[model samples]
Target: MDPLQAAVLQQFFEYPFEIDQTYQQGLAGILANNPSNTVLLNTRVFYFNRLTGSSITVADVLAYKEQSASASESVPPSNSAANDSKEQPNVLTFAQLQELIESGRLDEIPNNKTISGELNSAPPSQSAVSVRRKPWETSNDSSNIMES
Candidate 1:
């Protein structure tokens, strides 16, 4: 399977897509230097029951198929596409991925906003981010600090 360029990888991260049968499916390999253990399926992870490790290969995929088939006794072959989207980790070599991926996926990681997050309270530490006053505090020190 030919690897998708970084541009395509960025697009893939933004949206759920199907790999053209004529081409290949390797969303993970393109982004990360190697395939991570987790393959995100619509913002969730799909763990291969039989194959658990840092990377997945063609052989492992085949084994996964076999396992799924065997699990259901007396069931006929699946004729329809799976209801869930299937996005496998792209298994690119470190050099290949580094060359392709100019930027990192820090932007892609999800951030959750807590309703009642902790406020900045001063404790003794190497403090660069010093607040002269709490939000509710009347300004004396803050005025002086900001004036300086």
Candidate 2:
């Protein structure tokens, strides 16, 4: 077993719930510490199940990492680096956007792309048509009287 794997296991066993993150974070941390270490299969499953409220085998987890690694490796390092810098889109929170919009500085943002647009323009108002209400909702007093 790798020393890093042992350390991660120790950290997990000591205070598992200390981290306020999801099971994925825990799994990522463990794997990142020692990607090739496979000695703690049971521990991995147990930790994942407790954190995620779902079952996951070490093989399943490792397979995903292996696939990701292989896929990444296929791309040349230089191209991958360039693609990473190019592919990442500018992300902003609603509050930040609202600030920009309020300040009338939206035009200052370069390469701004609309993430979404109005889908099916507000279903034409049907004010001309009357909505059918439930029998109880109607103002008929007779309907309120229970019948045998």
Candidate 3:
């Protein structure tokens, strides 16, 4: 077989070349001259840089993503029993609204009209107030005097 293939098989299967042995220890010492975090490790120049400590491989990213997906999948919100009782109202009758407050289901808005005006919308007191804006200027007005 090829020499590189033989070397890889021997190293992996038999754990040969003494990961902590003399000949390999010298080689390992030569390999571990630095413990710096280098962005250039993304390139071939990294191997030449000779990292002293352990380095993270790309498999860590894939494993992290898979673990996150599994975690979120295990706790789906729709599976909760409390979800059945959390019915949202699209419409509320006057008596039902009053009962809702008494049953502690609905909280009343302060000074909101139940005694006089509409219940579904904001109070009539709002519409009664005349909101005035700036004076309307005619399109045929005179030229604006520019001051420097």
Q: For model 1, what is the error of residue 8's alpha carbon versus the real structure, in angstroms, after optimal superposition? A: 32
| Candidate with the larger lDDT of 1 and 2 | 2
Q: What TM-score, computed on C-alpha atoms, does each candidate reach? A: 0.22, 0.27, 0.15
Instruction: Give the TM-score ranking, best first.
Output: 2, 1, 3
Report the C-alpha displacement of residue 128, candidate 3, in angstroms.
99
Give the Cα lDDT of each candidate.
Answer: 0.41, 0.52, 0.38
lDDT of 3: 0.38
Q: How many clashes (backbone atoms < 3 Å, residues ≥3 apart in a chain or on different chains) does model 1 have?
A: 2
Q: What lDDT tens digits, residue by residue, belong to model 3 across residues 42-89? A: 221223223322233334333443554576787554543243223211
Runs in model 3 deviating more than 4 A are: 1-11, 35-148
Candidate 2 lDDT, 2-27, residue by residue in tens: 45544444444344342444543444
**For model 2, where is the 10-residue window of minimal lDDT?**
83-92
Q: Report residue 146 deviation for candidate 3 (angstroms).
A: 99
Give the residue spans of candidate 2 off by over 4 A. 1-76, 93-99, 109-148
Pick the winner on lDDT between candidates 2 and 3.
2
